[model samples]
Target: MTRLTETARGVYVIAATPFTDSGEIDFDSCDRMVDFYLDAGATGLTVLGIMGEAPKLTTDESSTIVARILKRVNGRVPVVVGASAPGFAQMQDLTRRVMDAGAAGVMVAPPGSLRTDDQIVTYYTQVAEFLGDTPFVVQDFPLTTGVQMAVPALARIFNSLPTAVCLKHEDWPGLAKITALRKDGTLNRRISILCGNGGVFLPEEMERGADGAMTGFAYPEMMVSVVEHHAKGDMERARDLFDAYLPLARMEQQPGAGLAIRKYIMFRRGIIASPAQRKPGANLDALSRAEIDTLMARLDRRLKELA
Candidate 1:
């Protein structure tokens, strides 16, 4: 398998775990989803992310899904799995399993318990030690993790850990952080910076030196186009594509309902067999669904105009 590296760029889509209405893992849908992502031009696929409902899956289910996706991908692109767990042992075990099963690398998010910069740096340093040469992504998502990582602290984590190869930057209002990281002397090495706010800020993030987006905003083709246009130095074209999907992207970014909205969009687009979530997770109601359908219709019409 070609492993993910600090130079990895373009979109590494945070994939949704497909489930049947009966709440069973939908393996068929998983295959279709993989094909859809690659067809839409994803550079890689990231499974079992926080939005992918990683916490709800059993250990066996996680492995099975990753293996299935890996087999389908057949090394067309890198596949990064989330290995974030409360204990280092669980994280290490998952990392080993996924990497051995052909995953490119794993992503680790700091525990909310971390309180100080030293603690944050120490946590990732230990993570690198536990990972033992396996490349990993630093998921710096303070909005969800509740662990704030200052730029310097992040630099320390990246500089001190040779195995840490990417930063899944999800800090709100974090454009400056991207600039700081890209600045000379911020770190002794370069790493991929993939922003993850559902690609709503992707145009700006790309301008601020983000390699691309590592997000699940349903319409991944939009993110792919934005990144490609920006890379070609076409700011107006990038923003135009981004603006076409901004409403749905913004709605899909809502704190609690984002995943539901994304699943609904994916299902309506026929990327998944069902829009079901596991127990304790709700699908969108009729009104919510109607609102999203309206936004999607508007997006389709706008995309045609842009084309």
Candidate 2:
């Protein structure tokens, strides 16, 4: 197994699930999307994430998609499958299937009902027990999960769970959390901290001790470039690149409508054959599409200037 580890850094593009106009999984587009990510310099790929429409997929479909992705990825880079579930049985089953399918690891988000610090810690304790030796990433996206993990709770988790190797840190205003986690003696051991607010606060987060990004922005090359420049100690270049894509990134980060916008851009870029969303998913109207086009145009010009 290509286990994910604390040293994992750089862009791990949260992949989108491609579907045909007829609403079937578009396997061909899945392959193309993987290729596009690799060409964009993605160090890793995360599948079945929230942006990937994991909840929308059936159990059989989820397993099939993971198998197809692992086959297509062919061990080129680590693939982390989102295995969060309402029950331990489902989570464990999914994790076992994906790991058996050759995934590098899994990402588990806290259940939305968890609130108190003890509840959060207990929930992860159960998760750690279920996952056993499988390395997992703790997804700390409070905006969507409704389960805010305080600094002390998070520290307790990291200190206790040996298998918790990385954090998909998406808590808004999470810069201080990163600083807290990186401070001396805060955690029993170090784990990678990657921000995921569509790379909106990536510059500050990086400066605040984040390892990198694990978000699903349409243009992952932008995230890759930002992290690369930051790693090279060129803050100006990093911010310039980030600023060039900020408009589109903001537009793509919309809550309910964001996935449709992202799929449309991916379709326009020829990474996917269609921007079709499954039932219970939103589709972009003419006005939204026009706005995205305008943003893309501005991004193009700005990127050229930066270049």
Model 1 per-residue lDDT tens digits across residues 86-196: 999999999999999999999999999998999999999999999998999999899999999999999998888888999999999899999999999999998999989
True-structure lDDT of candidate 2: 0.92
> Which whole-number lDDT from 0 to 100 does residue 146 have in model 1?
96
Q: After superposition, how far is residue 211 of candidate 1 from its true place, in Å?
A: 0.3
Pairs with backbone N, CA or C atoms under 3 Å apart (clashes), candidate 2: none
TM-score of each: 0.99, 0.98
How far does residue 82 in candidate 1 sit from its true spot (Å)?
0.2
Residue pair clashes in candidate 1: none
Show model 1 residue runs off by greater than 4 Å: none
What CA root-mean-square deviation does each model show from the true structure? 0.7, 0.9
lDDT of 2 at 52: 94
